[model samples]
Target: MTNSFINQWKFFYPNKLPISHCFRQYFSQFWFRIHSLPESKRYADTPAEYELLLNRHNQIIDDCFDSNASIFIVTGHYFSQSDNNKIYDPTLRLKYEFHPEKEINLTQANPENYDDDEEDHFYRPYSINEIWKKNEHNDLLKKIADDEVRAFMISFEQNIIIAPYDGGIDFIIFNDAKRNELINKYKDWLSPRADGL
Candidate 1:
């Protein structure tokens, strides 16, 4: 039979390497479990038009994707063979939606203290502070557990899509002890933060 289609981008955390390396390793194992394909994956990269990040510091990532992206308004785009399409990554558009009249408590003591050199490889809500998590993350995570892409719960307001594991079964076997180890290792590092509109 022909190879089953899988999202190549799903192999690791949507974010890039280094800081997300733990997640990358985790997905590497998870990928081994589900992926029976070949190296012909990376399909999404054909249309992805992002400026790769040079560094892996969390602070640097926070500034790269979101801070450098357009905010306030966003749109979905369709790409052709020769052009880049915005829909290639559904989470590409995100802008922080907060009330304007209240005392705004910036996430950390110094919101500007974030390193402004790099970009987040994946997607994140702009208001996603270190301690601030999403109210609707559980269901979305459940969908991932079920291996459903349509089940991928993304906040329309936030424009975030939780990607699946990549590399396939070649990375790790399903429900094996190594699977749990992979999960635990990457439990914290896979989050992506990009602020754009």
Candidate 2:
């Protein structure tokens, strides 16, 4: 389904902003309301099945919020990079709490083994205000534009990977083998169509 938020953003910004900038701005204003599931869920099935799972997960979150529970909302950006035939999946968690001062350390919350030398590599959780502030920076906009240009120049293929919180998986698996398998399996489902068609 087309994202109305992105559609409205493109309508307003058009040529005035980079696509990445628009994406960050859109997400900063509206986030995915996901239910905190006990396990992660995975669906390599049809797109319709995936949509059903997503809706179900969101419904759970809606129910929780409607019940007035103190919910800790967090966003996860799952990235997959292939280097030397090895695929690495890393999820960066952006945690938001009602009180900025009480923001929890995501590294500690979800402990993972990291190389001691990789001190600079860590998932630093951002407060809600910080996300909105970052969206306004010119430097970030430039960086995003440069990255998109580079990706386009290199003919990089982008795929949307979705892993439900209750899918019993901590990370989205997109290794070269799995990536090829999934693409071939869902080739028809993944094909692009004309906008607004």
| Candidate No. with top TM-score | 2
Give the TM-score comparing model 2 with the true structure, all chains together: 0.27
lDDT (CA) per prediction: 0.26, 0.26
- What's the C-alpha lDDT at position 71 in model 1? 17
Q: Given candidate 2, what's the lDDT at residue 81? A: 29
Write down the RMSD of all candidates, one decimal each: 18.4, 19.5
Tens digit of lDDT per residue, candidate 1, span 41-154?
Answer: 312232121111111111221222233332121112222234444455323323323212211122232236334623222222112222213322333222222333221211
Across 1-197, the per-residue lDDT of candidate 2 in tens digits comes to 13232233235445322222223233332212222221222332555644454444334323222333322222222221222221221112111232212222333433463334333222212112122121232222222222221100000021111222223111122245554554355333331433200
**Which stretch of 10 consecutive residues in model 2 shows the poorest summed lDDT?**
149-158
Pairs in clash, predicted candidate 2: 39-166, 40-166, 40-167, 40-168, 41-166, 41-167, 41-168
User: Which residue runs of candidate 2 sit more than 4 Å off their true CA positions?
Assistant: 1-41, 67-72, 76-120, 129-197
